[model samples]
Target: MPTVLDRLNLALHYAMETDERVTMLGEDILDPYGGAFKVTRGLSTKFPKRVLTTPISEAAIVGVANGMALRGLRPVVEIMFGDFVTLIADQLVNHSSKFRWMYNDQVRVPVVVRTPMGGRRGYGPTHSQSLEKLFLGVPGLKVVAPNALGDPAELLAAAIADDDPVLFVEHKLLYARPLLEPGKGDLIDFQVEQTGGAYPAFTLRPADSARLTIACYGYNFELARAAALDLLMEHEIFVEIVLFSQLSPFDLAPLFSSLVRTRKLLTVEEGTLSLGWGAEVAARAVERMDGLRVRRVAALDLPVANAKSLEDAILPSVQDIVNAALSLVS
Candidate 1:
């Protein structure tokens, strides 16, 4: 019955308990207010010295975290909004991500930068932007955008335990949903689950024979799921959906094998179409496989719209994904 926010907080608690070196930093994270979305609630009280509240500077927050990582401490820095990440691009893309390689593995920067990303709920353009694609292109940075509530807990634990810098992008819309069934193992239990193991992989009951694959991340996974249901009920066409919680250092071996069986691919993202993650996936698919047809359903190639109606217009909808799937079948 725990909401996504509750699960995230639990994950943080587990991280703090497991690692004596783990620390958290950001605005409004220390005391009463608990974080803008309350994901960091009670953490300040539980780990007084480890949980730090900072000024309004994203650059400073990331810079301080990078310095800490250099000194052998794992720092989890929270950026209240994804849109604010642009202001600290130099710190993230230039410094933290490059330190290890730049120094020939002489230093390892273990920093997890968490930011609430995506649109909807009228946050408008300034506060609502999906910039995961921007960080995905940078070398030495691990990017993760977990769609399921349970995965965030596990994935955050894994990212924190990693030696490299990670961009843990949490979707704003997914924070209020119920915990995903598969990732429901007890937080106190530290057993490692097998790869590709599913608690319950929802399959379209009818099972169309078409060779089309739907790949998506973050909130777009929800839209793709709804569209997949519609495709099964109305069109009798079934497509396989591969939801990736871990984006950078993407393990595409499974996806590539699936693609060989399916023969067609469609990528959906909430971010802009041009130079987005979808584009990279499509390009990689083409390069790795011969005679593969791939398409992308993403936000229009324009600046994020400030108006709610225009914002909705720019983002990929269920209809868009469905149409793309249908096109692959046709």
Candidate 2:
């Protein structure tokens, strides 16, 4: 029963052990401290030569990783905090992502940038944000966020092995949570199934037909799932939940199939509201399904406050999903 952080560390360990080309670099990722979240714990102890501790510069770290990737190496970088991902935008979006296509498929950049996102422990505005949306539409970059319902280790391995550059996002809150093992056993009242893909999308289905389908990613699913279960028990309102691991190359098949059963959908995310993940999902869904009712629950367009109470009020919550589901269904 390993935590999400444990699984991620295992994946890194396996990748480095099996693939001589794989290397990891970040700040404060050495012995004792390991990493800010300890995902790199024992990695340096195992592979001291490959595990590098650099200065506190996101741009420099990504630049180094990008170069290493181009010259026959697979580098997995840690941003320390997800917010600093912006500093690496130029090297990542322009250089690392574009090289393969720009070279007319002559080469591949197999680099994975891992970072923790979302707000729950009050890291404040800059430190606690879901900025994946900013990198979503980039031509050659792939955005991935693993959830509690699938094998994050497998997905991380896939990302490391792939020929393209991937931005691996981890919800900070998810590090300590245990992931539900796929196909081992079903939940008490819900049937959980995952789509077979490099990065899987898990669907949690209730016994009866659903009035609404709630689609979310990362830590937001935790809140959404609780709200869905509450709606079913307290109000007898069945809501199907679809949780996705890959965000950029978002697979709408699972969601579309759910919509076929439940005509309505409520997209929830921890990211800010206007022009965000929810908006894109809702728009793409409408293009495929006719008369498909949709609603989005997301954080307000304001910086996450440092205070716990203020942060909780600003970010999306279980109550918000419950209210949104009720409104969409009725």
Best by lDDT: 2
The per-residue C-alpha lDDT of model 2 at residue 323 equals: 91
- lDDT (10s digit) by residue, model 2, range 287-327: 99999999999999999999999999999888889998889
Q: 1-330, model 1: which lDDT tens digit per residue?
A: 676777788889999988879999999997689999888989999999999899998999999999999998999999999988898899988999999999998999999999999887677767878888888868898888766533667667778888989888988998987765542332111121223422112222123454677777777777877887788779877667676777776556555756877889998998888888888888889999999999899988776777888888888889998888888888
Task: Let me know the TM-score candidate 1 reaches against the reference structure.
Answer: 0.91
Model 2 stretches with alpha carbons more than 4 Å out: 182-186
Clashes of 2: 0
Q: What TM value does model 2 have? A: 0.97
- Each model's lDDT comes to 0.79, 0.90
* Collision pairs in model 2: none
TM-score of each: 0.91, 0.97
Which 10 consecutive positions of candidate 2 have the poorest summed lDDT? 180-189
Task: Give candidate 1 misplaced runs (Cα > 4 Å).
Answer: 182-210
